[model samples]
Target: MRKDLFNLGPVFGYFFRKNDPNRPTNFNLRTMHFINKLSLAMFLVGFLVLLYRWFIR
Candidate 1:
């Protein structure tokens, strides 16, 4: 439905939350964080590679 596509509250809530070290995280929350960090790191590496090729060529 058109409503589902526009309703982004849940998605935003999932990624933007308090980071309390003393508070324990469930398996799903930990997994999401890991994946988020991994993807961000990969993106930076790829961007660097692109810039290097651009400068050399």
Candidate 2:
């Protein structure tokens, strides 16, 4: 519900947690996850740049 939609705990967890033993991983899945993490990192960098510009202006 609303809490689930707004929750950031899982997002931070995904960045920090160790891989699960029972989960299956493959080349494709690993590549996709890497792309996702990279995109998120890029987005965060862009957002911070915008914020810095706003504050410095």
Error (Å) of candidate 2 at residue 12 is 0.8
Residue-level lDDT tens digits of model 1 in 1-57? 576888868756655676889978899988988898678678879999999999987
Report the poorest 10 consecutive residues by lDDT, candidate 1.
Answer: 8-17
Candidate 2 per-residue lDDT, tens place, 1-57, comes to 576888899898877889998999999999999998999999999999999999987
lDDT of 1: 0.81
Distance (Å) between predicted and true CA of 49, model 1? 0.2
| Candidate 1: segments with Cα more than 4 A from true spot | 1-19, 22-24
| RMSD vs true structure, all candidates | 6.2, 1.7
Each model's TM-score, in the order given? 0.59, 0.86
Clashing pairs in 2: none
TM-score of 2: 0.86
Worst 10 residues of 2 by lDDT: 1-10
